[model samples]
Every structure is written in C-alpha cells, then in structure tokens.
Target: MQKPHSINLSFLAFIGVLYSFQSILGAITFQGMPAVFRQSGIPPIQIGFIYLLMLPWIFKFIWAAPLETWRQKKGRRTNWLFLVVNSVAIVMLLLLTLTTPDVGLYFIFILLAIIAILSATVDTALDGFAIKESNALDKNWVNVMQIGGGYLGSIVGGSLFLLLVGRYNWKFAVYAMVVLLLMMLCYVLFQQQSVKELGQKSAKQSLQKTFASKQVQYGIFIVVIAQLGLRLAQGMTMPFFIDYGITLTQLGVIGSIGGATASLIAVFLTGLWVTKKGPGFVLISLLAVQISMYFAFYYFSEKAELTLLQASFLLLSNSACVAASFVALYNLLMRLTSPEQAGVDFSLLQGVDTAIALIAGVISGALVQYLGYQSYFLLCALASFSALVALPLLNKSSSPLKVVI
Candidate 1:
C-alpha cells in the first residue's frame, strides 16, 4: 500500500461537502423549489417532472464499478473526483443561472438529471476513498465527521435558506449556491489528494470476480434488503406527515431547526456511545429510539399540546439514528470489501441499496395515494424492524479498515 501524504481537518471537511450536497438538494427541493417554482410562474408538478430527470441517482452503481481501476492506473482518485465534483458544481450553477419555466419543463429536468448523474459519480468515488483511507476504529468517526459537515450545510441551506433568503428573494438562493460552489472550489484546489496506486489487478479483472463470486451475490442481497428497510423507515414517515396537512414551511421548520439540531446532537452523542459501548450498540439503540419516536410522533400528530414537542423529538432522534448509522454501515462496507476490488465491491453495495430505495420510492407514492395515512408509516416502521433483526449478522464483522494499496 502506498502511504498517502498526511491529511487534515480541511480535506475531511471537503469530503463532507461532497456527501452533504445531496441532503442540501433534498432540503431545497422539498422547501425551496415549491416557492421558486411559484415565483417563476412554473407549475408545482413541473418541479417534480424536472427532478425526474435526475433519476440516475437510483442506479449510479452501474457506472461506478468501472472506476475501480480507471483512476488507479493514473495513480490517484483525483482524476475521477475532479471530473465528478467540479462538473456537478458547474452544471448546477448553470442550472440555477439558466432555468426558466418557459425553457420547457422537460428540458430543465433533463439537464438536472445530467448534474445528478455527475454528482452520484462523485459520491460513489468518495465512499470508496473514505473506506480506503480510514481504519476499522476510525471508520465511524470518519463517517460522523463527513455527515456532520453535511448536516451542518443542510441546516443552513435547508432550514435557514428558505426562511431568510427565499422569503427575501428567490434569486438569493442562486447566489447562496454560487458562494458555496466557490468555497467548495477553493477547498478542492488546496487539498492534497496524494493517492498512491493500489498495487492490484486492474478494474476489469476485479469486476469479473465480483460477478463470479457467490459470496458477493449474498453480500449484495444483504446490503440491498437492509437498505430498502432503512429507507422505508424514512419514506413512510415523511409522506404521512405531509398527508396530515403539515405545511411545507412547518415541515421545513421542524427539519431545519429541529431536524438539523437533533442531527448535530446525534453526531456527538454517537461519538460518545461508540466510545463507551461500540458503533453497533450505538446504532441499534438509535434505531430503536427513532422507531419509537415515529410512533410517538404519529400519536402526537393528533394532539395539540404535544404535537410540536413530540414531532421535534421524533425528527431529532431520527437524525441521530441516521448519523450514528452512517458510521456503522460505512464501516460494514469497508469490512466486507477486498483490495483487488474496492470500487466494484462498494459500488455493488451502494447500487443494491439505491435500487431498494428506487422501488420504495414508487411504493411510497402509491401507498400514500391508496392506503390510510397511518399505514404508510406503519409499513416504514416494519421495514426498520426487519432490518433491525438482521443487524446481528450484518455487523458480525468487527474488521478494521485499510488502504487498498
């Protein structure tokens, strides 16, 4: 393994932004886009249609696996990361600059999809790099660090952006993103990549092995099923809350102030528990709390007095559970991989997970339309419950992390 030059807080923060940008998009879409669409004289459903263009995120794994050796022969992840992150920022900045309802709704979405494809590529590469860089013990902390930065950005872009910036001027949203892109660009220019080659088979040979191995097939299945379950836990609750007639502003408020705050707290709390007990212990506990909170929020959704407090707590706990889970799950990914095949292995795991989410997205939309409000969340809780049961086997490896080289 080639030794990387010493890395520091700044680079970790940069990596955090790479992942954080996703949630930022989610937050902006749910909260900011509706108003922006309205202001620009665009139909609300048109926003959704435009987003449908970015659907490639659902199966980014297909292209990600080839990168296993694509960057290696060049001696660093920098080659791919450069194309991915910078391209996404540039295209998104262009989207923000050029979009108009008169531009043809489908065209907007198609362009957005292009950006999403590039961003997802960046995300897949970063996950592979993160695993290669950290060891077993530092894995959770590394994840927490990245996600913590991301959630922090989410807080600003999600919660504060709409409340303060969008209200004053929708165009400010574009300005905010531009500044963020500049900041991101500055971070990229200064960061030391210093990735030495992973002296192993080229990406092509590893891709063949990944498909040939029965063990990998089983591994992929486990990863997919668990991801499906976990995502259901989120999807079910959110739509139900929307159905209950919670305004987008209210949802954003809870998510921004309450949700963001809780996620920040959860990151620190996760660090503490992982130190005291273990990442697995911390993760399972957070999940249980989240599930219980979901039920509590359901009940509180009806009560006038407890509604705000209970809902806030539910958001907070869920954020914490997800924060802690980032560490545990990513570490699991690192443990299950091989040096000869890191990109393919991680991409397969992520692809399976995202495929489950894609199916669940369709299921969620249909469930909300056809079923009673409560049933959607009930199904989500059940998904988490199932994944919870499988935790023991999935987390069986306490294996340390390693550099692929």
Candidate 2:
C-alpha cells in the first residue's frame, strides 16, 4: 500500500500553474473561437449551439463513480488517466489548429466538444486529487489558485490568443496555444504523485451518504444557484461588448487583462477574508456585490454608450467580485467533502454546479433574443439574488462553517 502524502505548498502552486494553462486551453476553444465565430457573422442563435460543447461537463459526474472505484484498486489511481485524457485534448487542439472552422462550423464544434469531454475528465481527476490531499488551510489556497489561474488563462487564451489570430492568422495563434499546452503537459508528466491508497469502499455508497448529509445537500444547492447567475451574465458579455463597438482585439486585451488583474486581487483578498470571517459571510457578501454588477451592466447597456475604459472598469470590478464569491463558495465545497470519498463527493457537487451553469449558458442567447440585452441583464441580477435562499441552510448548528470535514 502507498503511504499517504502530506499536502505541500509547492505542489499546490504547481496545480495552480497547470489549472491556469488548462483554462487557457479551454478558453482558446470556448471563448476565443466563439468570438471569432460571432465576428464572422454567426448569429446568436446559431452561435448559442456552441454551448452544446459543454455537454461533457454537464455529465462528467457519471464517470466520477468509476474513477473513485478505480482509485480503490491501487497503483497511481487516476493520475495516468489524467495524463491520457490531457494528451487527447492536446491532440484535438492541434487538429483544431490545423483545420479552419470557417469552412464548416459543425465540424469544428464537434471536434471541440470532444476536446471539452477530455478536458473535463482531466479536471475531475485533478479536483479530486486536490480535495483528497489538501488540509483545511490548504483548501483556501487551492481555491484561490484555481480562480486566479483561470483568470490568467483567460488572459492568454482569450485575450492574447485572439489578438494573435486577428493580428496574424489562425495558425499563429494555434501554434502559440500548442506551445503552451506542451509546457503544461511536461509539468503534468513530471509532477510528483501524492495520491494516497484508497480503502475498499463502494463508490455508490459514498455518493448516497454524501447526498444524505443535509450540509452537502445545501452546499450543492448553494453551488448551483451561486454560479447560475454569473454564467448567465457572462454568457452574453462578448456579444454585448461587440454591440457597443468593442473589437475582438480590444476585448482580448481589455477584458482579459482586467479580469486577470481583478482575479489575482480577489484571490489574495478572499483568502484572507474567508479565513477570518468564514466562507459563508464571504460567499453572501461577494454574491450581493455580484448582483450589483449585473445591474450596473443593465444601466450602462440602457445608456447605449460605452467607452473602452468604462467597459473595462465594469468588467474588471465585476470579475473581482465574482472571483471572490467563487473562491468562498469553493472553500465551502471542499469543506463538505469526506476525504474517504473525496473523488465522488467533490465531483457530484462540482458536476451539479457546472451542469446548471451550462444550462444557463446555453439558454442565455435565447433570453437575449427574446428579452434584449438590458432586460436579460436585469434578469441575471434577479437570479443572483436567488442564492440567498441557501444561506439559512448553511447556519445549521450541527455543522459549523469553520469546521473542516
């Protein structure tokens, strides 16, 4: 049997770097390409079909049980699976770079969907590993790194990658992405494994026990409702910017840089704040701030006049708030998991959160079509406010917020 490995700060940082690059890779396919598609005259309805690509994420929990069961069999657990899935994703990305989607959007979307599945698989494994390995203090940092890395990835994948494509060509941007992915892959290949040996427990029983816990049930509720409004608002943002005359290159630079900056700030700020105040307070406060951001967008949208600086400010401020909320929410999530069933428990919670967000994302275009941008923005604010319903559930005396699972 393998000895349990203590969580290390350096390994957590390494995961941050890996996650950042993963986000970059994901953004290249999701964020970057969607902008290109819209720029090429694709309508919102047609482009909204692109959200179907997220199908894998919506159902990734289906594999979580198998992954957990496999962990019990010993021998490096899901690390090899992670490697294999990421390798496939890299290959798919290379293919995407070689093939021009302008000729047939269907083919590219299908290909990207495959890549999303593989990426989600890798993400599931990595997340499970973090939950299993990290201590209470380390979980806060893990959440920070996750969001911070994602924002950084957005800068490179969404901003810089799009700029490259616009300034040079598709091939140039794709080659840059290839190089980044290669570097990420090298790290994954060499990272020291710390996964502990699993006991012979039924994955199904673990999941049932997790769901039976009221804390986890409420935690899942918060996770889903918390993310839904944010995803809905963000889903239409690129289109909203384009309507206000923000070009792809400008958006890439402004939006990405601003988001990354705000995210980094939120990472550090929320880390400290959550440690002092508890994740519940941090979650609720930041979520309220996020609601305000949506309304702010509605006000600006109604004015029908937006400067790059103003837009950047709004996006950056909102990104900071959202990042803080997300970190806090995840901090709560990690605390809810039982380490013995970390993979299944974490995946179920994350899967539901992702599935709801993806559902909102897929339907956001239709909402925009029917309600228009300003109305849609207002509706998103209402959705964000809905998360407050879960607050009372978190206050159960039996499971105090600060107590680590």
lDDT of the structure predicted as candidate 2: 0.74
lDDT per residue (tens digit) for residues 49-131 in model 1? 33343356556656766764565555445545654576565666456646553454455455555666766677666666655
All candidates' TM-scores?
A: 0.77, 0.90
Clashing pairs in 1: 1-405, 136-401
lDDT of each: 0.57, 0.74
Model 1 is weakest, by summed lDDT over 10 consecutive residues, at 396-405
How far off is residue 313 in model 2, in Å?
0.9
